[model samples]
Target: MSVSQQVIKDKLQASIGDIYHIIITDTSNGCGQSFDVIVVSDTFEGKNKLQRCRLVNGALKEEVAQIHAFGCKCFTTAEWSKLVV
Candidate 1:
């Protein structure tokens, strides 16, 4: 079974809380086995890179286990604002 992009996006929003922005991409060409993601949230404000990764991984624990590959870049709203500017 494969995961849908919406499922992942929804789960992150539900689990992470206070999401300011999010982008989810299907990287497996419809196989749903791989994804590339970016999440911007206040929940990440005080967290480091590893901590952010762990939070995202924990939120998507089951999905991550089932998928062949998953890549996520997490940031605080402040960090994201800087990047987009």
Candidate 2:
């Protein structure tokens, strides 16, 4: 597609402040378009998965409109620590 991985990362960096690693993939480009964004920010604190997804959806409305889908996994720094999977 027209957007590059770094571009997506940058957009996310701007939109989702405090993100630790804004990993992006573009399946549309036959690479890894399906993003697995690991954001370690307080912004995601208290927000459930659905709410986090919605927040990401709203934040990336412009990019979302262009992409096929999003494989989002947002988490707070604390929540990320408790993950076993």
Candidates in order have lDDT scores of 0.92, 0.68
- Window of ten residues with lowest summed lDDT in model 1: 1-10
- Tens digits of per-residue lDDT for model 1 on 1-85? 4589989988998899899999999988998999999999989887889999999999999999999999999988889999999
**What are the clashing pairs of model 2?**
25-32, 25-33, 26-32, 26-33, 27-33
Q: Cα miss at 47, model 2 (Å)?
A: 1.3
TM-score of 1: 0.94
Candidate 2 deviant stretches above 4 angstroms: 28-34
lDDT of 2: 0.68
Q: Write candidate 2's Cα lDDT for 1-85 as tens digits.
A: 5545676677777877677545465656555445445556678888888988787777777766765666677878777767735
lDDT over C-alpha atoms for residue 8 of model 1: 93
Q: Each model's TM-score?
A: 0.94, 0.72
